[model samples]
Target chain A: MNVGLLDADVYGPSIPHLFGIKQKPDIADNNKINPILKAGVNLMSMGFLIDEGRPVIWRGPMLSKALFQMTYGVNWCFNDRELDILIIDTPPGTGDIHLTLATKYLIDGVIFVTTPQLLAVKDTIKSIEMFSELGIPIIGIVENMSYFLESTGLKKDVFGKNKTKLAELECLARIPLMESIAQAEYIDNSIFSLKDCFSELAFAVKTFIEN
Target chain B: MNVGLLDADVYGPSIPHLFGIKQKPDIADNNKINPILKAGVNLMSMGFLIDEGRPVIWRGPMLSKALFQMTYGVNWCFNDRELDILIIDTPPGTGDIHLTLATKYLIDGVIFVTTPQLLAVKDTIKSIEMFSELGIPIIGIVENMSYFLESTGLKKDVFGKNKTKLAELECLARIPLMESIAQAEYIDNSIFSLKDCFSELAFAVKTFIEN
Candidate 1:
């Protein structure tokens, strides 16, 4: 399956290093390899893409058009791989870019991700509602940065205390936050920082497609 | 009350050319003028903002900052005139500027204006949740352009046959679309157009703070 990985930021920051990894598999292949194709956003640079720590800032309409061009406009990834699964990582909030996709595309489903808190849930709910209004089925929600497992055998939800109750409202799969998630800065070749954070996501994506 | 009227797409050919009108206005003696405070969002001029429309075009953080400046930044006419009310015309959907005020300012209440039909009401509900979750009190919901009254004296819901049924979910009000509203646009001023279409809104804002 030809999977199109979208860099949903207004500006594209996740594509070049990803492509570099593909070019030099032996040198770049590591746990941080997301194994997804990176489609760039507007007003982007290749240097920033390879740096891995750059932040992208953007707003709507442009974002929508960027994603649209990436999805339908470009020839993305692999040799004649049937475009079966399209994974889109959305920019935070219910803005025009997301709305453009919601109104324009025939998306199969969306996976709403958020931190486990009333505020984060509020953002997720608004996003889910946008998708729902557009007739996009929400497969499920993901609660990111959920809890920290301590070496002393104690766990704590750093963002909030009422994550379970919040999860009940959105049926969110709780993903534990780990120091391992932010340590990729030391590895110059790593494309992404988090691996354990995404193993659950990969499982979810697999389960969602299967079920 | 000194109030600044703001809308992203504040004009089109639909706006009239009244004698007293120009592209922008500071104040009208009659308190009946509709200023193009939030100026052109025309396709070519999306990101372009003049000195006046600064608060509208800059997306994300700039949009938020501009909105705050517009709210508290601009010297409102009614500020010292026993400013009992401040009315802000927000853009549709949950984006940067909208969320900024909904979460930052001490907004009195929000009355989400939506069209009739299950689909329209769904968006209204999401908007309601956005404001509600931000600790902003939702005054109620207004179902604008709900039904079209035909010349044959028959009323029909253009969006759905039973949209009112869908609108009955919460504190909702149903308003039928009227043709006289169209006729009033011929008055050569967008302000008059507003007065024609939303006379009740004028009165509502006046009374909501008075007593």
Candidate 2:
């Protein structure tokens, strides 16, 4: 799919560790930073630029500059092939980074991922409102940690039921609390092991974009 | 104990909802903002100042100003009684707010709360490093969502085992995935119901400070 992933969550960049890539990206001949490729996906993260365990320690303006470099200064073209899509994993808040992205970039759509907790849902609603107010199209909501499956074939709502009703948006997928997904990064395994799990979500996003 | 809670998590202020507080803080006669008193605890949060569901939409400088106002411009004295200890609930990253708090305020210690996941632990370590570099003493680590107890009386490691060894810090407590704790906010109930659950942690913090 020629997919590219940008870890815009500068404070806690997980993509580098998730993909098990520690090598710093090399600058291309065109003066753009080259993204690390793993398992048919191009990835970039603040984790790749800095030493492990060191905090970014940057303010709003510095964060904006970093965001600009990631968005516009990175070489998304690998071997003369352009990227079909770029997925940006942002930090969980409606702060400066979000405002910068919303105002500067040409975002296709934003998919809100939240757990089945009232507190998380409340925060997600605020983000939805901020984006909606800025004229951004909301893709849908992906309810992660929806439930846990027991050996006795029972679905346990570990975090509780999704009682906080979202404002008329489509519920894309209810991803179960899978040990495989949780330990994927720690065990140095690719999340593509559960590709079938998100097939419906992929299709929904495709349909939304096409129409 | 006379305790005060300063919700320094300006991005997603959960204290207001967690404590079910909505009234704005009144301006005291001495030109300081009077912290809202609820259940014998003086509380202050960015959520109290803003309308429900509206995002703060502020940059770094604005956040610093708000934090300064909350910390210095608020009256921690209630009924002519001074606060014995003021606990600051910070956001989940080692960023501007954390830096500001560590540099500008007199912090006694920091307690890191993490789920039983490698990624979360990794992020927590970065915070630990930042605080340690800033000469702030770390109290200990509180592993939350450590396990879930089933009806059959089996403790399940829902996330995973705590394989990430923290450097020389005491493991304060391993709180289980309790439904009571998760739904406390939604039901508008005080978290004091689970006070017994956190008694050991409270004791650990008390002991650490005393020593």
Candidate 3:
């Protein structure tokens, strides 16, 4: 059965609730994840989530095993009958975990996450290089928490909007960021409902995975 | 609270069960864990047990996060009772996970797991160097599953027939493997007649953590 191996760290906000199953005792304590998904979709959140307070000092093997357990140990149910997708929420790094995930798992594609800032773009570029060497499909990049819109309705590109520049470095299908996903609620739940939608990105991921 | 992290991984087939805990799961499930000891003697199991089948592609961030969740998360009951000790099951290499455990956590001592086998010895040397670089105090290495003895009084050092040579590479406390370990019933329950008797190694670890 095809499955998704999600990675959750302190770097990002809680995953928006998806549907089908209720929250288990393992995740009951967290105020982050959403309650349930719609009828068809089911999400199984795995691995330790870093809270805002404590410092997380993890290296590699630990990270790799947890993900493996999440796949092998956790009871995962994929909606698609012939599902074969395992999308991992990898941290921004060319470190050990990233290397192992790319090399070990015959991953169909990678949806790299980053911000619109220069540093994030720079790191994402490095990420592309590392994965490219491993011959992993560079599906696209998700530019999260892009820019801040002041109360005065004036939008400032705090991180210097550089989506186009990033997509140039890699053949990215979609560059979703501040303008599209500036809100927190939408992201935490993986909701996609914008007038000028990034359906293109989501579709790209869907087509890439399904193909 | 004086608490020490014990490497739960150092399980011997002959050693009697200590503190009423099984060394490993009898019938292995996907989530195979080398039992965790509660507060008093927090012995953490180190190293991965591979099944003859699928590949064991551990040693990454997922692995590291699992260790953190196991160490810091979970019901790791420890209070400020003054420092006692924390010994981790270190992999036999300068792998990233080992390095993080050495540098990130409050590790007082380390016990290397090695076999008489040339391969194990080679990897153990690398492990020592990695630990040394992190500046963590290594109590000593323990030659594991060292030799095999038959009921007919025949002794074989099949694993590491060449002894002392491995010890010279890194001074260690040798633990010979007992043939009785082959008894499946004893192993399934792990109720060994002669429980863990590594007094010298225990003494070294205790001295390091308490001091």
Candidate 4:
């Protein structure tokens, strides 16, 4: 499947590091930018436009404009063929970026990811609720860092058992506390190791979309 | 000194819990809401306004409005006496909240608190840069969780050593990793233990302001 990834996390874009892509996307004559192709996936991020150390010191209007341009101005299609899926990674918060996306595009659904801590869970619920109010479908929640292993070989609930029960929504995936995932610099390669975990997530997403 | 803590992180307000306050702030007949006084420090947070489980689910305009109200509409003074200092704890990002605060107030300066991780330091720099552009003074960075003690009594940099070197900015405080700071729900009493650390921070602020 052809997938396009748009890193809308303007403050700290990680797509470049994850894919290990050094070069930025190509800009066309028509002002529509071409997304960089990496491992069969088309990727675009603000990391391409700005330097590594420089911050995008923009207010609400500029942020909204940047997000809008990233979504619409960037060509996601492959040789006139439309993209199968376009995944956008936004900064954590219900702000201008979300508002622009919600108002500008026909978003399919939103999947909330939260660490199994109450602090993180509370924030995730607020985000989910915001998306729901925007008339978007709630995909489900993915609980990360759910458990850790002790020297005795027994699993321990580090952030406590995530009893995340959203009415009418299911818990899509429970990604275990993998030290490898935390320690790794690149998520693209690290994600491959958690085959079963991602497989379950994929299945859950499919079910949610199909239903 | 009289200090007012504004929990501008509307999405996930932690000031109430950190202060262990149960009662909500009082609202006067003039529509000015009073901030809850705790341990001689007046505190205000969205945590007190809304139900614990219910989400705010607000858009950009609403979010901005709420933030503006929290800063302006709230009665942060005693008997018409102005507050000596007001410290705003914002969520991690450069979004509507930051913009609203920067534009609305003549902020003396900003102190950035970041973990020793490169990922976090990079983001903190971006935030500082943004604040500088907004004409707010960059009041140095506080490196939290800088290091931890090992079983063998060696100090190990878990998140890697923080190497922040801006030409004009200084590293204010290298807060050593303390489990007590992380685990404590109420920060009011807990802050008394870190008198030295905060004392240094206060001195830094004074120096930055004088210069």
Off by over 4 Å in 1: A15-59, A164-172, A186-204, B1-69, B72-211
CA lDDT scores, all candidates in order: 0.49, 0.83, 0.47, 0.74
Tens-digit lDDT track for model 1 on B1-211? 3444344332111121212123443434644322343332111111123332122212345566655544454444422333345556665555565666766778887777776545345445555655666777655556675555555556655555444344344434456654443223233453344453456655564455454
Put the candidates in DockQ order, highest first. Answer: 2, 4, 3, 1
TM-score of chain B of each: 0.65, 0.92, 0.62, 0.91
Roughly what TM-score does model 4 have, to 2 decimal places?
0.83
After superposition, the stretches of candidate 3 with alpha carbons farther than 4 Å from their true spots are: A1-5, A8-13, A16-22, A25-40, A47-59, A78-80, A150-153, A163-196, A209-211, B1-211
DockQ, model 2, C-alpha based: 0.75
Per-model interface RMSD values are: 20.8, 1.3, 25.5, 3.2
Mind giving the per-residue lDDT tens digits that candidate 4 earns over B1-211?
Answer: 6788889887778776677777877897789889888777788898889876566655556768888788788888854668878899888777777877788888988888887655666677788877888898777788776665444456656556545553246888778755456445466465677788879998988777677
Pairs that clash in candidate 2: none
lDDT value, residue B17 of candidate 4: 65
Best by TM-score: 2
How good is the docking of model 3, as DockQ?
Answer: 0.05
Candidate 2, residue A96: how far the Cα is off, in Å: 1.3
**Model 1 Cα shift for residue B18 (angstroms):** 44
Per-residue lDDT tens digits for candidate 2, residues A66-168, read 9999978999995589988899999888888899989998999999988878888888888999999999888999888888777666788876786435545
The lDDT ranking, best first, is 2, 4, 1, 3
Q: Cα lDDT for residue A200, model 4?
A: 89
Cα-based RMSD of the predictions, in order?
20.0, 1.9, 23.5, 3.7
